[model samples]
Target chain A: MADMRTPLSRARGLGSAKKGTEHFWMQRVTALANIPLMMFLVGALVVHAGSDYTTMTGFLGNPFIGVVMLLLIFSACYHMRLGLQVVIEDYIHGEATKLLALIANQFFTLTIAVACALAVAKLVIG
Target chain B: MSEQSKPARPLSPHIQIYRWTLTMMLSILHRATGVALYAGTALLAWWLLAAASGPDAYALVQEVSSAWYGRLVLFGYTWGLFHHMMGGIRHFIWDTGRGFDLKHVEIIARITAFLPPVMTLGVWLAAYIYPGAL
Candidate 1:
């Protein structure tokens, strides 16, 4: 039999179909970023729990809280997109369904990002 | 490459023939927990947008969330978050190409599956035991 090492070594340079490590690393990076943000977010929500709209609005309107909320939302949506993309790839069988699902996932996540950004901008800048 | 001349290769053991293991169960549960978390994010978005819209909208959200079904949803969301977080740590360990030994892998999988539910219950119990303390 021909040596297996030559073909195996040559294949290493071609890289993974999806450029593998990027997704893995991004998932970890976002997961780490979320640790603190998740704590702050839950704490913030608890603090605002019984507050009325005016009170809550004023709280969110604060520049610091607004920016933090914006960051949390964007990072979360990005993290979610990455995670769901993997799930879809694993479960969705047909090529067409997978492609469509991927497109929808990106569209939905991007819409959330834009809407969240706009809401925060209005709160902080208005 | 002749059709009749091709060799019959020896086959390796596969998952179908092997008994299910703790590690296998945890691997599937991790994906399930991830899907649950994805749904929870939609709820978060709704809460945020409702808060942004004003009093009436915010009140709508509060009313729903304070209801029995809403509380159940929130409970599930909390469970999903903690479960997925632990699973992610397990994945991180796996990513480093360590911890795949027979004994340690099963132990870690079992721990990941059990720890999150305990933590979730602990948090809720505390919230009830001392509402003010939380």
Candidate 2:
């Protein structure tokens, strides 16, 4: 299976696909977005603790709150996905296992994001 | 044939080779907390989805969240969230290329470690003292 190319020739064309910077940039962008979003989220959760169904829904149902909540879900999930991808890539060594883990990471993050978004949208819309 | 063709190579010294520093610990803790938050997101999703579902479902979630174990996990999640958030801020600061000096880096690392637990405790304390004043 070995090709007879010189080592320099072998290594010359094998490095970076030129798209890694996008991943790096997006990770930072989403991270910056998460700071304020998470603060607002934590505040809302604290304020809503022990609230009854109607009360809780009424609060989350507010257009402004709901919109911010939606934003939080999006930013947080995106950030979470990016962060977990790094984690998986770092720790999952087996080729097949790494691929499976990366796929599962995407699916899990997508599920959480969609489910959370739907919940917020329903409450807000209703 | 392939097995005989290549000999086993010597491995480089790993994590165990070095003494742990606060900066090293914080860096690892940042990733550790990030992983914790990844799982914590599920709890958040569950809470939101349950609220959307109906009163019975929402109440079940509330009941569980109010339980001792649930509260413990929530406490850990709170700490993890704050810890990770501070770690991110430290990273952002470093990204600006301002915190690389040895003295400053150690100071920044200490702040990352100290602030989160304090903030977490403050939140919990406020929640207790004022009871949803937030």
Candidate 3:
């Protein structure tokens, strides 16, 4: 196996497109980060369930919860955008359609991420 | 590399031609659940924004989400979230260059399939039954 590689091919490791497993690594990194963040989020929701707006805002106002939530939104959205791009790439055969879908995916994920972050910031800052 | 000149052959046997396997089903489910969560998180956003907007808005969101149909959607979303989360963990383990063994792969897929519903039920039960205790 050690002898089986062309020197150029062996060193790059990213293949021709040069993405170099970037998506794979990012997916794992975000997934690992999301585990605890999501747990915290679910906990917060459960604790605040059926409570009034004041209680929900108060829960999110706590600095630690607020920060965990921010991280969760950012990482989860990024991971999702990556996953969806792959999905679009795989199923959409038309090149132009695939590109448009990819762009729309990013736009949608980014919009959600921004909206969620703004909501968190408002709660934390107020 | 001409289109019409190429020999007649199936492009590739996608899901249509191949016998389904646990890994394949789980793989597809992972993506399906991911897409579901994409929408599910939109609900989360609505909740947050509703909270930020004011009491009236927040109450409306609360009323909507707590409605029977809303709860049903929420339940489905919960299952999707947990299922996708477990699937991520499985993929993470694979990224570590382990868990690809045939025996363990099936085991992991089975656990991934069953554990999410159990966790979702547990959370919902606790949330609904012991509202304040949580």
Instruction: Return the DockQ of model 3.
Output: 0.51
Task: Compute fnat per model.
Answer: 0.35, 0.61, 0.59
- Candidate 2 lDDT for residue A62: 90
Candidate with maximal DockQ: 3
> What is the TM-score (0 to 1) of candidate 3?
0.88
Model 3 stretches with alpha carbons more than 4 Å out = A1-18, B1-7, B131-134
Instruction: Flag clash pairs in model 2.
Output: none
lDDT of 3 by residue, A17-93 (tens): 48877888898788888888888887767767777777788888888878888999999999899889888977898
Each prediction's RMSD to truth: 6.4, 5.4, 4.7
Weakest 10 consecutive residues, lDDT, candidate 2 chain B?
B1-10
Docking class of predicted structure 2: acceptable
TM-score of the second chain, cand. 2: 0.89
Instruction: Enumerate residue pairs that collide in model 1.
Output: none
What is the Å distance of residue B61 in model 1 from its true position?
0.3
Which of candidates 1 and 3 reaches a greater DockQ? 3
* Per-residue lDDT of candidate 1, residues A1-126 (tens digit): 676688767676576554657787878898877767876875665555556777777888899998888888888888989989998998797899999999999998888777777777777776
What value of lDDT does candidate 3 attain over all alpha carbons?
A: 0.85
